[model samples]
Every structure is written in structure tokens, then in C-alpha cells.
Target: MAGAADAATTLVGRVLAGRSGALANRLDLAGIRTKPQDFAFLIGVLAVAVLAATLLLGAGWLSVIAAAASPVVAMLFLNIRIARRRDAFATQLDGTLQLLASSLRAGYSTMQALGSVAQQSEEPSASELARIVNEARIGRPVVAALEEAADRMASEDFHWTAQAIAINREVGGSLAETLDGVAHTIRERGQIRRQVKTLSSEGRLSAVILMALPFGVAGFLMIINPAYLAPLFASGLGIAMLAGGAVLMVVGGIWLYKTVEIKF
Candidate 1:
């Protein structure tokens, strides 16, 4: 039994190792410090636990579904974290750019200004800027590093900042003033984004409620009377109906999300 268990663990590790690089990048974006193998193992454990719980509840089919959904749920959580981190990074960009501009006005070089911002700012901004500084110190082109950071964070504002820096390097100009102008534009964009979010809050909330309603009803039914939802899991016809409803729900959810999402 011990040898069999060891073999199984090794097999799982090997299977998970194939995607570790991509998963590592995603985990880094999400600000999670976990190793990919460990995260994969945790997800496996969670799936087994969920499967066991469903089995204990006497829903074999539901157990299978739960097992299948566990990794997807974990990915959703990872994406949410990445999004929140990206938002925080974007929110800090205006102040960070202003500070960088101030440093430049104080006679600092571009790299020096970036290093100063890395020291003075908060996380995400600080970490990202520090990375750019480090990469530049190691002889990587600062513009390239900045562009990579922008891509990693998915920040248009940061991408524009990189462009500004690149252009400033190519020609002779007042870098400080250029950064100040960029900061002003970013500040204005932030204001507009907040206004849009405020205006669309109601619609986003409605979408959330609409998406959750079916799950909420199903849970309520499960508690009130387990048998009420049993056929949906037990009978082929009922299972098909449930699958169709789930597909429709997913499509509707995506439609609602796209409808409420305002891109600038």
C-alpha cells in the first residue's frame, strides 16, 4: 500500500509538472506564492473532499460533477485574484507616475526615478517597478522591461508610459513634463472609470443575483426536501434537462456580463 501510494503521488506530480510554467506565471500574476505542484495537489485534495461529500449525501452523479468542477472552480478563484491585483496596480499608476515625474524633476535619471518609485510606493506597483529596475540593472533594455511589465499587468496606462519613455529616449525632450502629462491623463481616465463603475453598479448587481438564483433555489430545495432534486440527478431525462438549463444559464450569464461590462 505504501509503495502504491508513493507511485500515485509521483504520477500526479509528473502529470501536473507539464503545465507548471504557465501555472507559475498565472500564480505570480495572482500574487500567490505557491508552487504549481503544491497548488495542483491542493486542488486534487479539494476535489476528492467534494467528491466524498457528495457521495455521503447519496448523489453519485453529483459527486462526479463536483469532482469535474473542482479544478474549474480553482481556476476561477485564481483569475479573480489576478484581476483584483491588476486593478490595484492600475489604481496606483497615477500616483506612481506622478512620483516618478517628481523624481525626474529632481534631476534623477529615468532608471533612478523608477528605482525611487519602487522604494516609495506600495505593493504591486512597488514590486513591478522593482522588477523593471532589477531587469534594467542586469543590462536588459529598460523600455523592454517596462513593456513586459505593462503586458504582465494588462495595463494600457503602463503601456502608454512605456511608449512615452521609449519616445523620450529616442528624441530629446523634458521627460519630467512628459510624465506629468501622462499622469494627468491617467488620473482623468481613472475618474471616468470610477464614474462608469458607479453608473453600472445596479446592472452588475442584477447580473450577479440572476446568475446565482438557480443555485440558490437548488440549495434551498435540497435543504427543504432532498427528494425534490433527486430526480434531476437520478433520471436520464431529468439529467438532460438539468444539463440544458446549465448550458442556457452559462450563456445567459456571459451575455449579461458582456452587456454590463463597459470598456474604455
Candidate 2:
């Protein structure tokens, strides 16, 4: 049984890692404290709950469909968490950059400034910087550490700043001035991002409401008129229709989300 469990974990890990290790990278970027095993366990539990719910409803095909979708749902939740954390980190980034520049101007080394950021800032930047500082402490190259963090955060501007620092270290330049400029750019971009978000708020909200409408109506009907939608759950064709409608709804949601999401 232990061997079987271990094999299951290995298989799940490989499946999650995928061809590009994108899931692993996302998990890292999200700064989820749980291990992969824990994540897999939680997903399994949710899958089992879904399976149980469908079974209780006497909807075999629906049960299978729900079971199949369980992992996707879990991944979506993880992605949401990662997004929220990254948003928070982005909010903190300008201040972090400014602090690092100030430290440099105050005669601190790059590592010293990073260490201060690690110690002083709030998460997820503090945690990210602390990881970088820890890596450097273990004799890894600081630039490499910064680059790795940038990649993990999926921050292009941060990556550019990292590259600038790397070049400065190799060619000799005013590090403080470079960092100050980067900080200014980051702040300006953040301001623009806020403006865009504000301008698009109505569309974003409408998208969310539209996405939730079907589910909300279904839930309401379940309470007020289960008999009305009973056929939709009773027949095999109904199950298939439900599955297809779910797929279409997911696709539409993605399309709407992409339409509203403005990147600067």
C-alpha cells in the first residue's frame, strides 16, 4: 500500500510538472507553503467529495465528469491564489525598488540592499528577496538569484532591472542612478496599471457577473425548482449537454477575461 501510494504521488507529480514544468513554476511563484504531496492530497479530497456528491445524486455520468474536472478546478484555484499574491507583490515592488536605491545611495552593497529589503519589506516581495538573499549566502551568484526570482515572479520590468545590475557589475556604472531610474519607471507603470484597472472596472465586473450568472441561476433553481431542472440531470443526454455547456462556459469566460485584461 505504501509503495502504491508513493507511485501515485510520483505519477501525480509528473503529470503536474507537465512538459514545461509550468505548474511547478506557478506553484513556486505563488509561494504556496504546502508541498506538492499536500496539494495532491487536497485535490484528491476534493475529487472524492465531488464524486461522492454526484453518486449521492445518482448521476453516474455527471459524477465521472465532475471527477475529471476536479483537478482543473484545483488548478484554477491555485492560479487565482498565485495571481492575488503576484498582485500584492507588484503593489509592493515600487517601494522595494526605491528602498534598494536608497540603500545603494547610502553606500550599501547590492547584497546589503537586498538583505535589507528581505528583512524590512512585507510579503511576497520580502519572502522572495529573503529567498534570494539566502541563495546568495549559500555562495550562489547574486545576479543569478535575482534573475531566478524575476523569472519566478514573471516580472519583465524586474528582469530588466536584474539585467541592468548584472551589466553594471561587469562594466562598472552608477548602480544607484540605474536603480533610481528603474524605480521611477516601475512607479509610473504601476500608476498606469491602476488607471487601466479603474477604467476597465465596469467591464471586468460585468464579465464576472456574466460568468457567475449560470451557476447562480442553477443554484437558485436547485433550491426553488429542483423538479424543473431534474430532467437536465436525469438523462444521459442531459449529462452530456451539461458537460458541453460547462466547456463552452469555461471557454467564454476565458475569452471575456482576456478581452478585459489590459497589459502595459
The best candidate in terms of lDDT: 1
Q: Candidate 1 lDDT (Cα, whole model)?
A: 0.92
Can you give the lDDT of residue 146 in candidate 2? 88
- Flag regions of model 1 displaced more than 4 Å: 1-13
Q: Candidate 2's residue-wise lDDT over 153-220, tens digit each?
A: 77887897898899999999889888888888888887888899899999999999999999999999
Residue 5 local lDDT, model 2: 71
Candidate topping TM-score: 1
Residue 107 CA displacement from its true place in model 2, Å: 1.9
Q: Estimate each model's TM-score.
A: 0.91, 0.82
- Total backbone clashes of model 1? 0
Give candidate 2 misplaced runs (Cα > 4 Å): 1-24, 53-68
Cα lDDT over the full model 2: 0.85
lDDT of each: 0.92, 0.85
Residue pairs that clash (backbone atoms under 3 angstroms), model 2: none
Clash number for each model: 0, 0
Inter-residue clash pairs, candidate 1: none
